[model samples]
Target: MIKNVIVGIDPGTTTAIAILDIEGKLLYLHSKRDWKREEIIKAILSFGRPIIIATDVNPPPKSVEKLASSFGCKIFYPEISFSVLEKQELVKAFVYKAKNEHEIDALAACVKAWKRYRSFFTRVSYLLSKKDASELFEEVIKKLLKEGKENVESIVEKMTRKREEPEERVEKPKEKGEKVLEEKEKKLEQAKKELEILTRVLSKRKAELLTYKRIKLSLEELEKCRKELEELKRANNILKRFERIRMKKFEPLVELESINSLELEKLDKLLGLENRVVYCNSLSNANVLNNFGIRALVTECEEEINVANLEFPVIKIEKEFIQDVDGVKCVKEDKLESLLAEVRKSGLIKWLENYRKRKENY
Candidate 1:
């Protein structure tokens, strides 16, 4: 899914107002000299209400805030340094397709100025207080760039350099001026030795660099997994709390068969307002109850609570008045009671009981 974001900036003489999607896809580009803020804002809103509005202009004008507030969107103020190079790259790419030299020059100048500003900002930020990780990453990139440049230079030089091989001629032993074959052999051997040493050093360095990259990637993945695990643990704790509350509601229902008629009435009244109740005397009855909204209050017990209304299913008793069991839980009694009162007012419990009994054989 493409999430939407609208970026807006007050364009300077050389730069222009632009809007990009969340994926950094440019949607609208306009020169500041020709367009007003209202016009630009209107054009953007016409596409869709933006979830985020970004601006480099300081203390966003009241008019902009009012427009944003009307749409219930958030305004983001990203530092100006963030978008300068991005804008240049985008304009440069556009200008590359232009038909005229003037357009090309204009675009190139804009790109150059933006790049300089971006570099200055980056240098200042880096020098202010360099983060260990960021510094390491910068160092790695610089080393790689240096190595790449050196390799290209070396390849070019090799291709251009003239190579002279020894001329094949019959060896005529000269008395005084001829170099010995032993000297030539020694020179060749020395050259081979140096090449072998250089090759070995390069191979070792490459292996070490690969190992360092692997370790960095592994640490990043581990950190991501750790955060995910923490989120899961929090969710699990919430589920456990819910389970405990559910189990507690079941205890009264399980003891229903052992209690006297009066006690059963009290228990029924307590469980009814506190939770959705159900009665099941046999396995068939349990199945019938299960088909309804009720969940088992106690394992192997006939009684259950209605899952929808969180009330007990009605069991015919001598009393007509319904008692509230809101205070039965350990905590949040008031909140629970209030919720139950609201549910009762909605007539959901009565509807739930009738719906369940009619649908199921119980």
Candidate 2:
């Protein structure tokens, strides 16, 4: 049923269908006012099977999509919507006469698709018989659609080599030749069955091997992430010990900030921080550290802030207060990114689980 024909459809209140050969010859053309989609599909199939379904509109109407999908043909439309003048100009060379606007539009689409793939069409039609050319054209189109694309000439060349293989020549008496032909035919049928079985087996094994490779990669990533989780758990335990020590140390009440009102001589006893100064970029950073049970000499206040529902001890210091401490250095910028990354790996785990299911099904 494969044929190198282009089918153009002008779908609306009236549906028009046109079929043209690879050489731009019009084989069939018709438009019906009340025809349903099924009737239109049948008329196109009656002429010859089509390789391309053409439409004058970009993002073709649903009627056109149904026809193209039913016929298993690639849909073609101009990148930009074609103007009436452009459609008329394109159709003029293809057909000598047209009864209606639908006919003109359908023929215009057919001509455009024919011209687009004309170079490859000429080579295929010239080198092979019509039947053989039809088969090769169908295969090449399938491959082009499936694999993004392969060069048309390269596909034709490979097919040519396959068809031109040498065949053995034999001579015998007429009666003996008939008997030998029958025996050879029986052997060929048996060989065909064996080839089919082996091909199925090979295809199945290839799929299994691909699944195995994907599963192996997923397992490795999962193990690495598990080890990282184990390390984070150990780090969390260390932070808990810091909290325990802070609870046991010093007075019941401590001066919250290093304000100017506080005396410099009594600063060590007034401030809880033992010669340490910690800076807070915003209120969020304090919330993150406190959630993990870690405490530091914060240089920001917790008063009147509602960022975290569970509040903790946060103190704000004046800009000049840090000058009282010596050898102060800022923390590295990447520490926050590293901490957030460890806490937000649920998405990664979900993705790996999905990948594993897809590979297993394949």
lDDT against the true structure, each candidate: 0.45, 0.64
Local error of candidate 1 at 65, Å? 3.1
CA displacement after TM-score superposition, residue 118 of candidate 1 (Å): 20
Give me the displacement of residue 148 in model 1, in angstroms: 43
Best by lDDT: 2
The residue pairs in collision within model 2 are 300-315, 300-316
Worst 10 residues of 1 by lDDT: 316-325
Alpha carbon deviation, residue 36, candidate 2 (Å): 1.4
Over the stretch 1-362, how does candidate 1's per-residue lDDT look in tens digits?
A: 23343545444333244455433445655454555657767766655445444444346546546655654655544344334455456466665443443333333333333343344334433542333223232233233233444343333333223223355676567722346767777899999999999999999999999999999999999999998677677545544554565555422222234324454444343333134443223322333333334323222334443445323323322121222232222223343345446545555766787889999975
Question: Against the hidden reference, what TM-scores do the models get?
Answer: 0.22, 0.41
* Residue 137 local lDDT, model 1: 26
